[model samples]
Target: MDRITVLLADDNLIVRSGVRALLSRDEGLEVVGEAGDLESLIALAEELAPQVIVTDIRMPPTFNDEGIEGAKIVRKRSPGTGVVVLSQYDDPEYAVGLLTEGASGYAYLLKERIGDGGQLSRAIREVAGGGSMLDPEIVSALVSPAKDSSGLNAEQQRLLLQVGEGKAVKAIAAVTGQTPGAVDRAIGELFLVLARDASVGGKDALRRLRSLHTAILEREEQGETLSRMLPSKLAAKLRADPTASSRTERLTVTVVMSDVRGYSGIAERSDPGALAQQLNAHRQQMNAAVLSEDGTVMQYVGDAVMAVFGAPDPQPDHAERAVRTSLRMHELQRALDAEWQKEGLEPFGMGIGLSTGLVAAALLGSAERVEYTLVGDTVNLSQRLQDLARPAGTTVASESTVTAAGDRWQWEALGDHLVKGRDTPVAAYRLTTDTTRTEPTPSREEATR
Candidate 1:
């Protein structure tokens, strides 16, 4: 299972320990960071960029509502971050303050009744999936004596919630068991209700809803547009918003070169259709992992994927981001492997390389076939390192990259070797993903000429 990265914050060590112990038992939850104050929580959230945050409702010098306040700031800065606020207070209004704008990707839980950590795990999973959950007591406190109706029927209210969660009409239809046409009608009615509310009270909230509505429309369009385009170097150009073309400039970057190990043998053994489908899925996983870290996909050569970090734009932490992204790519392949195995399909094994140094990056070629390319010794080293990583599902990085990354990741040095295209021996560090089993080290001679 690909574990969900979590950042835990609590001023009380005892409380933090209890929560950590409880969460550690769950195989799918990984507490990657911990903070003891609101400031620390915010700092760690940005630094580590965890998928979910669990924070005590009060902490720091104020010891007031710092946790809830910090959670709001986190969600504001990164809308995709899931926050679960833990509180000793049973006040439903406190929870309401944390979710006034929208309830999606937010959760409020009572610290006392976490109930063996199941509810905590469930809440994390729900918010991580862009859904909402509230303590049952909290829910009853708000809904038991239902407030005055706002002229929205139950179905219309549900549709409004879906829209706030950024679900497209087709997705809403899938969930509600309705046709797309019916969902469209419901959305129109919901919009009208929101418009009425905007004219009266809560105009600010309605404005946010309007923005989300516009997002849904644009997302639908983007899906259509992306479906018709080839996604590679052009995607990088568009994503980076590069202004110039055919102009090369020196850029310090982390270059990642990955290859699908044993692709030739798999191609010869598998049917053409099956092989094509596997390649498509593999590319999607690799591309998504790279793009998630703000890295640019440089190009694709057969079964190889080239990614550049800090190019088209300067990223000081490019080395760190590239190493972390490599781990995610490894996780992606493992998850894909399990799924494909269940269906009797060929599984993909990935070898990743990362080299951080100065490089020349620019757009090249005519309008008919333009591409954003990276050219430098760093690129060559990355390729050699990836070939050395051919022990499937492995990642190897240049010594310079490992040093630049600091203590962020655990690595096992694979010693010095003359990697092809380089005169001197370059030391390679293997990012150790599985600590329990000792992976075989690549022989220097086998790794290069």
Candidate 2:
């Protein structure tokens, strides 16, 4: 039997090398080519025509959308080529976008699992065989109950969930004991209820279906079961558990800051209607990318988006996701620019920053105005990092963020500097590929300070 040919694309050399080494042990697989950037990966796909391409979502030069864009190109050029995207975390919006374009011959897996060579090989084989694979976690996130209920009626929401779990209309009918036709009609109604305004007619129906399906899967995996009324006594007992309270204790978290590069300039030049349209488009793209990486959009301050990770739910890899999202956002901006140019509008740019440290993140403010948010020097530093980014650019992780990210990504010491309001200067680094780099040069004040 012919060995399955594979092309690997990841900005991190160590990750690519590790994956290649792992696959080398599999007799059925062969790593035919590799790329560290998006453009090269596309070129390699065209040249090698590999049976499979495993790509990282963010790659060098322009880190964002490279993997997805490359996958789309491979599908167009070599319809038989299977594309498996490896991301640091599952992004539902990204998954939705990919599936909407056509889900066959593709897979998206979390990078953490690449070590499971058998699973990776199996996924490759599945996609090469013309099947689709989505991270169960991503599927659950997309279809969370909150999202399904955002615009859907209770019945429509339930139907959407069932359909998203890959249930056939007949199977749905069997479960609900309704006729297949009725189930199908219910699905249609559900689609209509959730369809975006732009999807009123034409190809939008399919998009709506895909979105609903993806969302449902996400919710299911998150263990978000249907709401049930727990006995009041039991609920009170559970809430009174001291361990649960202790578990909620605050910890250091990474904060991500992003903003349009030239919001004021754009507002000055364009009419309110045009500016609103532009801002909406930008927001959608950013929201999709951020949410896909499991980052929460804390709030939108004018044209800026403040997001947080490592809180609400702490994941050891949150800092890595934050950095990766920042890179992807930069890439998305470029793609959006090309889109805007087609409409004769100026290209918009973005700036992003990330920082990690202990911060107080909990419900605060007056009873009526209470909300969940993070507050600390770390948060301020993250905001300052965003301020430091050049238009259409990004800066990542103060020394604290890098420490928290552990070994998930490569780091290069960019040196240390004093941030405003901090008594002492802090060490900083540029997030390199996934491999670790040498310690940054010691601060000039190492002895003095």
Query: Judged by TM-score, which candidate is best?
Result: 1
lDDT of 1 by residue, 227-249 (tens): 33323444445445535444688
The list of candidate 1 runs beyond 4 A from truth reads: 1-243, 433-449
Model 2's TM-score against the true structure: 0.43
Candidate 2 segments exceeding 4 Å error = 1-248, 406-412, 431-449
Please name the candidate that would achieve the greatest lDDT relative to the true structure.
1
lDDT of 2 by residue, 1-449 (tens): 44677999998999999999988998888887899897899888776567799998877787777788878987886666788988986656677666665565778888787666477888787777665676767656655533434566677768767775666565688889899778777777766665542333424444645664554333232211111211122223334552432233476678888878877888788866455556756765787678778777676677888888776667678886787787777778789789779978877887777898888765445533434557788888887777666536556568777666665555556566776777787676655453233554333234224
* True-vs-predicted CA distance for residue 36, candidate 1, Å: 56
The local lDDT score (0 to 100) that residue 282 gets in candidate 2 is 72
Distance from true location, Cα of 273 in model 2, Å? 0.8
Instruction: Report the CA-based lDDT of candidate 1 relative to the real structure.
Output: 0.75
